[model samples]
Target: MSIDAPYATLDPDRVLDAVTACGLWPDGRLLALNSYENRVWQVGLEETSPVIAKFYRPHRWSDAAILEEHAFAQELAEAEIPVVAPLPFGGRTLLHHDGFRYALTPRRGGRAPSLESTEQLEWLGRLIARIHSIGARQPFEHRGRLDRATLIAKPMQAVLSSTLLPSSLHAAYRAAAERVDRAVADRFEAVGPIRQLRLHGDCHPGNVLWTDAGPHFVDLDDARMGPAVQDLWMLANDEKAMSALLDGYQQMRDFDFGELALMPALRAMRQLHYAGWIAERWHDPAFPAAFPFAGEARWWEQHIADLHELSEELT
Candidate 1:
């Protein structure tokens, strides 16, 4: 599909047709479509058996990343991590349809548990540690350190250059952005070498599914070779959430105290990046309501508050 093509509206019949074409479904009823960066359809066939057909938007993701994800999923499956392995179709990791790339995997049954609960929070932390443990021993090339400078400068540059954000938010966003930039720099300067490992770039609670066995991470699309702390930082932004997750990780592997101490600043950088992205995409009607211009403004306000709090500690 064209990079500028409108978002595709998934219909049950169309999903079934696509599944039938892939030979995974002679006949089935589409249960639900999980529409996000990609489009996934839950298909129910005979005997309560279900599978998911995922259509990848080439415009949204680089071909390299998509293919790498397929390989990564395969490797994770081999390591006996509970994951939905992609099925081969037409000898390709993706199926081309109307200029969009698509793939399929059987749906793993599970519900997303609340991160608010102590038990669930602990479970999440341990699961992340296991993923990191498995990732640690794997032979993957490192994508050099995503240092404080790059993380801060990139979003600030983007937000400043983009005309998407309103003038009302311009000052607040820039101020918050600068504060975080300085905070990250100061924190990293005092810290030792930060270790890089294969990381699940987006490790928010939503990305993990709690199953009978344990939490199974989906959307390995964001997986990359970067600082392991990037994953931890994302999950640890919320104090309660991080405490729970850390409890779990400590059970499985060791965590660097310095890195844990530096998490607040790292997490602030992450939130800043996301705020910039949201501001840049605000004009789009399909942009998530949760991240509207007002939301971005509020985030910057809160971010500045956090930055002040961190700055006080640093001083």
Candidate 2:
């Protein structure tokens, strides 16, 4: 669990030992292992219900994020928001094991849809509106806001600083980074105050779980206070999808059209962030093809082209 310890090779026996120590299940078959930055597993025993075990990466995630998520989950539960509830383990919101921190939560019964239908998209919009409304009334602080600069710097820095990626990707990464930076800078300067608010940060289809209650959002790991439009842009990267989601969102919350116009560029920048991260972590095959730069450069080229098209429409 030391930072120097090889994180890629986790000991299954040690993880099972940790499970037993937690008093949940000493002997249960590890059902599935998810390839995330953090260690995740589906643990189940015949006598008891199944649950998810998440081991946090030390130094990678801030303690504030862990605490904030627990607090936010509790607040949402109190408000009857259909979100995953985080359970306290090891007398702390986060549990320490093998030099790393971990948290456990009961796995809800449902799966995320690959694509959001019109009705589902509308429901998602309303749900987000409600979350924003509730979050607005609460006193909270985020590590930082998502501006053009932060969106550009974090990924660029990650790409440049990462030792995992090869030298061949450096030039392509820098060029893409510069393109995103320029686009964001020009777009932000033209538009003022693109409606900042508490956002889920990552609202892609993967994070949404469809349950009997409706769409329930999980994996609030990236939740933070940022531009309200950020979530919208993240969800609606394509015109058809954006229109559907926006139609759904507008039904619940009042928003300005001006901010909607900025979504394409915002989304393009967001895509670049993921792309750069994937390039750094490309050695790992779990990176999704949906994000920019993960596949051929043509995908990113099209995204940049879309940004240009959106800019003309906005003007």
How do the residues 1-315 of candidate 2 rate in per-residue lDDT, one tens digit apiece? 334443555566766766666777645578656545666877775588777777775565578767877788777777877788677665566776666577777887677743547777777778777777776665446445666556667767776676533555556656656766776677777777655666677887777888776888777777766656766666664677767777777777876677765676776666666645665555443444323244565654554455455445434
Poorest 10 consecutive residues by lDDT, candidate 2: 285-294
| C-alpha positional error of residue 1 in candidate 1 after TM-score superposition, expressed in Å | 3.6
Residue pairs clashing, model 1 = 1-99
Which residue pairs overlap in candidate 2's backbone?
1-98
TM-score of 2: 0.80
What residue runs in model 2 are displaced by over 4 Å at the alpha carbon?
2-9, 114-116, 138-142, 161-176, 237-244, 279-315
lDDT of 2: 0.66
Q: Give residue 146's lDDT in candidate 2 (0 to 100).
A: 65
Alpha-carbon error at 286 in model 2, in Å? 7.3
lDDT of each: 0.66, 0.66
